[model samples]
Target: MSLFDIKRTKFNSSEVISDFSHFKRRLLDEVYETKDELQLVCSSTGIFEQFIEILEGLFLHIRQTQTSAPKIRLLFPKSKKVNSFLEKTNISDLPSVEIQYIHEDEFQYFIAGVDKSISLFSEPRRNFERGFNDSFFNVISLKDSVIWHNSAIFESLWKQSILENKVKDLSRELNRNNVSNHNFVRILAHELKNPIQPILGFSDMIQNNKRLDSDQKNELLKIISRNARKLDIMTNNILDYARMENNIFNLNLEIFDIVQVIEELLGDYTLQVNKKNIKLDLDTLSKKIMIKADKIRIIEVIDNLLSNSIKFTERGQIVISVRETDQYIVVKIADTGCGIDEKNHKKLFSKFYTTDKLGTGLGLYISRIIIEKHLGRIEGRTNTDGIGSSFTIKLPVK
Candidate 1:
C-alpha cells in the first residue's frame, strides 16, 4: 500500500518494512516467483469482497494478454467457506488461471513463478514494472537471495493473511472517473471566468482615480478589488484543475535561484503580512539556491500557500525554509495559524474546500496542480495539537 510514488525508495526502507502490515486486511502482496507457482497473500478484515473483485478482474486482464504465463497456481490458507467461495468463481471462463486449494493439513512444496524481476505491488496509476528493492511483505522465496529472504518472512504470516484483490478494480474505476472529470474541468473552467474580466477592470480603474475623495475611493476600491480578485482566483482554480486532469502539464522549466524567487514574491505580499502584523521571515541560508522550475507557476503556488496561512493567523509568524538536495529542492512554509482538522487532510487539494470566511477555496488546489506539473509535490500538515499548519512544496532540483 505505497501511497505516493512508483517504487519510491527512502533511507528508511528498513523502518518502512517494519510497518508493512499496518493496513493488515487492506493490503495485498501477490508475488510470481517462477514458471511453476504463483502466490497471493492478502490482509483480510473488511474489504474482502472488493479484494476478490479486483483479483478476478486481474485474472480477466491476464486472459486478454497473450503472455506465456497466463497459467497461475492459486493457493489459499486452510478455511472451509473461504475455499468454497473460491471454488464457485468460474475459472473456466478464465482459461489462464490454474486454481488450487492448499489445505492446512498437508502441503510440502510451493514454488513462486516470478521471471526476470518481480513486482509484488504494481499499481496501475504508475509504471507497472516499477518495484521496491526491499520486499516489505512476508513472502517465502525459493529462488534468489532477495526473494528467499522476503518470502521466509511471508511464510510465517501466510495463515494470518488472506489473498485479496483490493486495487485492480479500483484502478479501473478511478481511471474512468479521472478521464470524465478531466473533461468536465476544462468545460467548467472557461465558463466561470468569462464574466470576470470586466469586473476586475472596473475595480482597477476605480482604485486608480485621483479625482475621487481619498477615504471613500480607498474603501470602494477595496471592495471592488477584493471581489474581483476572488473571481480571478476561482478562474485560476478552474484552469489549474483542467490542466491537472490531462496529467501532462509541463513546468516550462528553467534554472533560477530559490532564494530570489521567494524574495520577489514576498515583496508583493509584504503588505498583507504587515496587515496581519505577522513576522514573516525567510530562512534561505544560501543567497542563490539554484533550481530548475517554472517561476510563474511556483510563484502562484507560494502566493496561494501564503494566502492560506494569512487567513488563519491572527498575529503569528510565518517561516519560509529552502533546502536544496541532489534530486529535489524542499521548500517549506510553516505558519502559526488556526490549524486544519485531520479529517480535512485528504481534501486539501480538492477544489473549493476552504474554511476561511472570505476565501474561494481554489488556491491550494490550483497550487497543487502547478506543483505536480513541475515534477514536484505539495503537502500540508497541521501541528499535533492543531494550533498551526505547514505547507511543503518539493521541486526537482534539476
Candidate 2:
C-alpha cells in the first residue's frame, strides 16, 4: 500500500507512524497542498533543523506562484542553537514568515498544521543524541475536532510568546538606562567643576596681587566674567531640564526680526572668535525676516549652535546664514571643524548623549525642545563638503 494512503491506514482518526522519513514525507506533502495558512511549533533546535529546508522551499514556492502568499507562523523554544540557526540561514527575513520564541519549559512537542484541515504531532525522545527517529510517536489527525483543538493550542501559545518577549525587552532597556544615568552623573560633576575652578582662581589672583598693573587686573576680571557666564549657562540648563520634566516650561512669544537677533548674538561671540583666530561670517537673504516665537528661547538655540561650532572649530571659518521662503524662515550655522560621525547623527539631540568630555549633553537636547515648542524643527548633519558640520533651524514666518 502507499505510505500515506489513508485507505491503507484509517479514516477520520489518528494514525501513528514510527518511521521519521515516512512522517517527514507525509508532512511535506500536506504542506504542499496548503492553500491558506501554515502553523508550526518545534520543541527544540534539533527538531527545527530537520524541517527548516522544507519550510524555506514552501516560502519560495508560495511567493513565486501565488498572488497572495499565506501567513506562516513558527514557534520555537528559546535556545542558543535556534538563534544561531536563524542567523546563519536568514530564514526570518523571508516574506510572510513570523517567528517567536517560547520558554523551553513550556514547549514539549513538535506540531505542524496546514489550514485547519490536517496536523502532525510528534513527541520526540528527549535524548536528542540518540536521534529523533529512535523514539518518535507521530500522530496524523484528519478529524475536525482534533484539528480545531490543535489550532486553539497554537493561538494561546502565540499570545504567551508575545508577552514573554515584551517583558524581556523592557527589562533589558531598564538595565541599560541605569548604566547610562550613572555615567551622566559623573560627567555632570566634572562639567560643573570646570567653570567654578577658573572663576575662583582668577578672583583670588585679583584680590592678592597688589603690584599688578591696570591692564593685568582688567584682563583677570575679564577671565572671571567669562567663567561666570559659563556657570550661568550650565545652571540654566539644569533648571530648564527640571521644568521640562515636570511639564511646567512656558514660552514668552513675541514678533521680532530674526536677522537682527542673530547679528546681536554674533557680536557677543566676537571676543571668543577673535581669541581663536577663526573667521565668522553671516549671510542673510534680507535685512529683516519677521517671525513669531519665544525670543529668548530662539536666541538660546542659536547660541547653543554657535557655541558648539566655535568649540569644535580650531582654525577654520564659521558661517551663519538666514533666508526666508513664502511660509518659513531658515537659519543655518555651518563651520569648518571636526565633522560628526554619521552613526552618531541621530543621537545628537538625545538626552544624556555627548561627544565632548566637558559637555553636560543637555544643550542640544534643550535646544530641540525649545525649537519644537515654537512649532519649529532643527537638524544637524555633516557639511556637504565634509570639512565640518552644519545645523539648520526652520520656523514659521508670521
Candidate 3:
C-alpha cells in the first residue's frame, strides 16, 4: 500500500477540516513561500543517509535552475563515527552550493535553514513503523535576524565535536571495512565448529565410556544440542544481514495476521527470558489484524526487538504490547533495562552501529529496511526516568 493510502485510513475527512491538515498545510505553505537559507537537521543515521541522497538530488536541480539561490546547509550528528562518515562524503563536486556539517550532540534536533526558514527534525516519541502519524515538524523563518540563535547553538556543538585529525584515505578505510567483514566470516566458521565439535566429541566419549550415568550423558547431550542451535541461528543472522546489506533481501508480501507474527517471535523470546529469569509480559491481542507485508521479514523485526529487549533487561519485566488503529497495527516491545542516552537513540537503527554489544548490528537496520519496503516505519523511545526503552513498529492494515 502507498503511504497516502495508509494516512487516509487513519485520518478521516472531518478531522482534516477542523484541525490537523489545515495546521500542517499552513506550516508547509509558509515554508514553500519563505526564501530563507536552507538548514537541515538530520537526527537519525537512517535520516543521515537519506539526507545525503536528497541533498544530492536537490543540489543537482538547483544547478539546473537559472535563478535559484544558494540555499543549503547541513547539520551532522556530533559523534566520532558520524564525523568519519561526513569526512568520507564528497561535496566538492557541488562547488556553487555551500554545505556545512554541524554536529549537535546535545540538542533535541538539528536546525535546518530551508531558504530563509529554519526547519526542525524532532526525534519522535516512538520510532516503530506505526509511529509516523505522531511525528511533528515545525518551521520558522529568520531572514531579518542577522544574529541567529540556532546558529550559536549549532556552533557551540561544532566546536566541541573533534576536528578531522586523521583524513583516512579511501583505500585505507575500505581495507579496514573489508577486514571487519572477513573477520565476521571467519568468526562464523569458527562459531559453527564450536558447537559441532563438542557434540561429536561428547557423543563418541559417552558411547565409549559406558560406566557414566545416563543422566550425566543426557545433560551433556542437551548442552550440545542447545549450543548447536544457537550457532545455527547466529550463522543465519549473519547470512541474512549480508544479503540485506547488499540490498537483495527480497520480501514475499502477503496478507498475514500481524498478531501471529508477534506471537511467533514472543514464543522464541519467552524462552530466552525464562532462562535469564526476567519477567515477560504480553497483552492479549486480536489474532486477525491482517496487514499486507513480507511475513518473514516482519517476523525478523519482532525477533530483533525482542532479542534487544532481552539483552538489555537484566531482571526487570519485558513487555510486548499490540494495538490496532483504524488504518495501522502497532507493536511495541519495551524493556526495563539500561535506557539509552538522548544522543545515541537515533544511531541505534543505523546499520553496523552497536553499543559495543554482542551480535552483528545489522538486525535493526535490516528490520527498518523491510518495514520501509512494505510502506511502514520503526522507531525507538527511551524512558523519561531511565527505566528502560521501547521500540515500536507500525504496519499498514490492508
Candidate 4:
C-alpha cells in the first residue's frame, strides 16, 4: 500500500501474528520519527499500560537527540483511572506532553497521529478472552486529506475541553463563596440582636421610671446611646456587604486630592488617638497627590483601617503614609498595636470574622468591598518584629 493510502490492521485472537509486537515494529518508529507534532485521543485507561514501551522509546530518542521533540498533545475522557495513570507516570513532567480531559460522551474512540504524514484510529474489542497481555483492538491508518480532517476534529475537541474545565472551576468557587456567606448571615443576625435587646430594655425602663433621679436617668441614656451607635454601625456594614454580594455597589467617582483627605481624617481622629495616649503621624511623598474615585467611600475605607489600628493599640503610634506610582495611588496605614496573629491574616476580610471579642468583625470586610468597587485592593501584613500590623491599599490611576 502507498504511504498516504488507507490501511486496516486488526489484533484480535484470530490475528495472532499481528499482535502488540508486530504493531509496534511496523508503526511506532515511523510515528515517533516525525519531527513536527504528535496527537493522541484515548477513550479508556485499558490501553494506557500497553503504550509504556512506545513512550519510553519516544522519550529516549528526544533526550539523546538533544533537539526539540515534536509537540505531543493527548486528550482523554475524565476518569479516576486515567487521573491515577497520569499521576503515576508523571506525564506532566514529560518533555512534550500536553494533557486535557473531555466528557466521555464527546469522545468514544482511540486516535493517534504523528505530523500530517501518518495517523491511526482504533475501535476497542469488547469480547476479548484474555486480559492484560491481550491485544484486542483494531486500528486503521489514513493520510493526506483524511489525516488533516481528523486533526481539525481533535483541535475542536481540545478547545471544548479547556472551556469545560474553566466553567467548572468558576462554578465551584461560586458555590463555596455562597456557603460561606450563608453561614456569616446567621452570625451577623445574632450580633445585631445582641446589642438591640439591651438598648430596647434600657429605653423602656428610662421612659417608665417616673421617680428616677437625674443622675440615674443620665447613666441609662448614655448606655442606650452607646448600644445604639453599635447597632447603627452593624446595620450599615450589613447593607454594604449585601450590596457587594449582589454586584450592585458602584463607586461615585470624583477627582480629589487624596493627601488632603488623609490629613483631614488624621486631624478628626486626633482626640480619639489622644484618649489612648497614642501618637498619630502622617508622612506624604507629596503634599497633594490626586486621584479620581468615590471620595466618601475612600474615606470610609481609611476610617475603618485607622479605627482598627487605634482600637488595638494602647500606648504606641499610628502612622498614615501617602505615596503615588505612575499607575497606582498607594496608601499604607501602619500601627504599633497588638498585632494580629499570623494565622488569622487570611480570614481578616471575611464577613463577621474577628480575632477580638469587642470588635463587630464587619469593618475590614466592608472596607474591602468599598475599595474593590473603586477598582482597588486592600492587603494587610503583620510587622516582622511581631509588634504591629500594616495595611496597604492600591487604587488604579486610570
| RMSD (Å) of each candidate, 1 decimal | 24.9, 25.5, 26.2, 24.9
Question: Model 1 shows how many backbone clashes?
Answer: 16
Candidate 3: clashing residue pairs, number? 24
**TM, every model:** 0.44, 0.53, 0.48, 0.45
Distance from true location, Cα of 220 in model 4, Å: 16
lDDT of 2 by residue, 1-398 (tens): 01122223343567778887788888888887877889998866666767776766766676676557677898987788778767865768767779988767433467888898887876664556676665666778885544654565565456446533443443354366564454655565566556656555665455445587879977766665675566566666776776776689999989999899999889778878999999999999789988889988898889889999999999989999999998779999999999899999999999867899767688999999998987889999999989999999998876
Q: Rank order by TM-score, top first?
A: 2, 3, 4, 1
Query: Highest lDDT among the candidates is held by which one?
Result: 2
Ranking by lDDT, best first? Answer: 2, 4, 3, 1
Error of 4 at 111 (Å): 85
lDDT of 1 by residue, 1-398 (tens): 22122123322121123232332222223432235344553332122232455556555555556365545545544465455556676554565564433334221222233442332331122221353222233222222323332233233233112111112232344467763334333333443443344344443344234366756655554544444444445445545554565574666777777798888767656666787799888997688998777877787788778767876788789888988888888989888887878899999888656675444455787787788777789999996666799999888766
> For residue 362, what is the lDDT in candidate 4?
67
Predictions in order: lDDT: 0.54, 0.75, 0.56, 0.67
- Per-residue error (Å), model 4, residue 27: 99
The residue ranges of model 4 lying beyond 4 angstroms of the native Cα positions read 1-233
User: How do the residues 1-398 of candidate 3 rate in per-residue lDDT, one tens digit apiece?
Assistant: 11122223332111222232343454344334436455555655544543454445554555565265455455565566556554555443454444445434332332454443343323333343544334433333332221133443333333222122111132244366674454433433454445555555565445445477978867665655554545545545555655665567777888877777777666655556788899987775675677788777787678778877887889879888899898778888888898788898879788667774345555787778878887888999897667999998888777
* Candidate 2 steric clashes: 0
Q: What is the lDDT of candidate 2?
A: 0.75
